[model samples]
Target chain A: AQTIHQWPVAEIKAVGSPLSLGCTIKGKSSPNLYWYWQATGGTLQQLFYSITVGQVESVVQLNLSASRPKDDQFILSTEKLLLSHSGFYLCAWSLDRNYAEQFFGPGTRLTVL
Target chain B: SQWGEENLQALSIQEGEDVTMNCSYKTYTTVVHWYRQDSGRGPALIILIRSNEREKRSGRLRATLDTSSQSSSLSITAAQCEDTAVYFCATGYGNEKITFGAGTKLTIKP
Candidate 1:
């Protein structure tokens, strides 16, 4: 069975600080990866998606960027954090991008102050 | 925006009761996915209904998709306290990206 792992289960950062979050998927090769963010009592918004290594697509511009450096690794980072960047960030993967069901990893809770 | 203006908000029910949540989309979609998100956890797909199928069932959960109305509904039978969570409807328009609606918070009272 495939398993997904996310690093830094939770983080609290001040405004203007830098931030980085990571996700890794094991047991599955060449899977589609996605990043989603949800604010407190808000909808889950798609941030970015990658179909292959070294390429990523932006779904919504939240001043964040994502990179799939390895087949099983995805990273989300920002140089300067804003107060509005606080939310729960989720990492998801699907077998393919053809409307397949997505599996999620234990998310990272971010608090910006 | 694909989501309707009115948010599905919240629903409360007693144990063993049945509840249904509805969603409406703006554009055409080939698949509708239902997901459940527990507090502090990422949303997990619970059901997926295709456009060709009007309704699909799994255990105590049922999902209905209506292409004509551009809407979908998910129903849970004999609800339990563990069922308390936020339910979201996601639509994929034959693309790599899927859009999620503002979820409906369901609270099951024991």
Candidate 2:
């Protein structure tokens, strides 16, 4: 069975601080990875997606960037965190992008102080 | 822009009652996915209905997709307290990306 793991289960950061979140997938090869952000009671927003290593596409611009450095690793980073950046960050993977069901990780809860 | 938006913002029902949540999309899509998100957790896929299929059932949950109307609906029969959560409808336009709805908060009273 495939499993997805996200690092730093929760984080509390101040505005203007650097932030980095990581996600790793096991038991699956060459899967599509996606980054999603959701506010406390808002809709889920797609931030970035990567089809292969070193190639990431931006779905929404929120001053965040993602990189798939390895086949099973994806990282989301920002130099300066903003108050609006606080939310739940989710990592998902799918076998294919076309109508395929995505599996989500446990996710990371971020709070900007 | 948000692709899929649920008609009802929230719902409250008693246990064993049947509830239905509706979603309407703006663009054409080949598939519609239903997901349930518990508090402080990631959303999980509960059902997926394709354009060619009108209705699909999984245990006590039923999902219906109407291509002509550009809408979808998820129905839960004999709801339980555990069914209390936020339900979202997601639509995929080809291979571009899957967009999610705002979700409907369902509270089941025991």
Candidate 3:
């Protein structure tokens, strides 16, 4: 079975600190990976998506970026965090192209204090 | 683009009762995905019903899709307190990316 794994289930950092969250897909190759953020009120927002290695697209700019270094790995990182960055971060993956039922990982909740 | 929109932003029901959630979308889609999100967790795919199909059932949950009107509905039979969660409808218009709508918060009173 294909499973998506995200690390650092929860994080707390002061403003201007660096942030990095990761997602890994097991048992699948070349899957489409996505990063999403849910605000405190639970509004789903798309942040970034990657189709393949070395290519990531930003749907909404937040002074943060994503990188797909390998086929099964996608990373979300920020050099300086803002208070607005605090939220629940989620990583999701879909199968091949058009026929994809997106599967989500556990998720990482970040608190910018 | 709000491709899929769900009605009944919140619902509260007694255990063992049947409840239905409705969703409507603006664009043409080949499939509609239903998701359930527990508090503090990522949304998980509960049901995926395609356009060619009218209705699909999984255990006690049933989902119906109507491509003609760009709408779909999910019904949960014999609800339990564990089923209390936010439900979302996502529309995939042949695009790999699925756009999710604001979810419906369902509370089951056990």
lDDT of 1 by residue, A25-83 (tens): 99999999999998998888889989999999998899899999999999999999999
lDDT tens digits by residue: candidate 3, A1-113: 89889999999999999999999999998999999998865557778888889999888799999999999999999999999999999999987777467888999999999
Error of 3 at A56 (Å): 1.3
The residue-by-residue lDDT of candidate 2 on A32-88, one tens digit each, is 999999998887888888889999999889999999999999999999999999999
Question: What are the chain B TM-scores of all models?
Answer: 0.96, 0.93, 0.92
lDDT for model 2 comes to: 0.92
Q: In candidate 1, which residue ranges exceed 4 Å CA deviation?
A: none
Candidate numbers sorted by TM-score from highest down = 1, 2, 3
Q: Rate the local accuracy (lDDT) of all candidates.
A: 0.93, 0.92, 0.87
How accurately is candidate 1 docked according to DockQ? 0.78
Clashing pairs in 2: none
**Which candidate's TM-score is highest?**
1
Model with the higher lDDT, candidate 2 or 3: 2
* Residue B72 lDDT in candidate 2: 95
Off by over 4 Å in 3: B4-8
Write down the TM-score of every candidate: 0.97, 0.96, 0.91
Q: Candidate 3, residues B1-110: lDDT per residue as tens digits?
A: 65543333889999999999988889888888899999888898899998899999999999999878888999999999999999988876444556778778999998
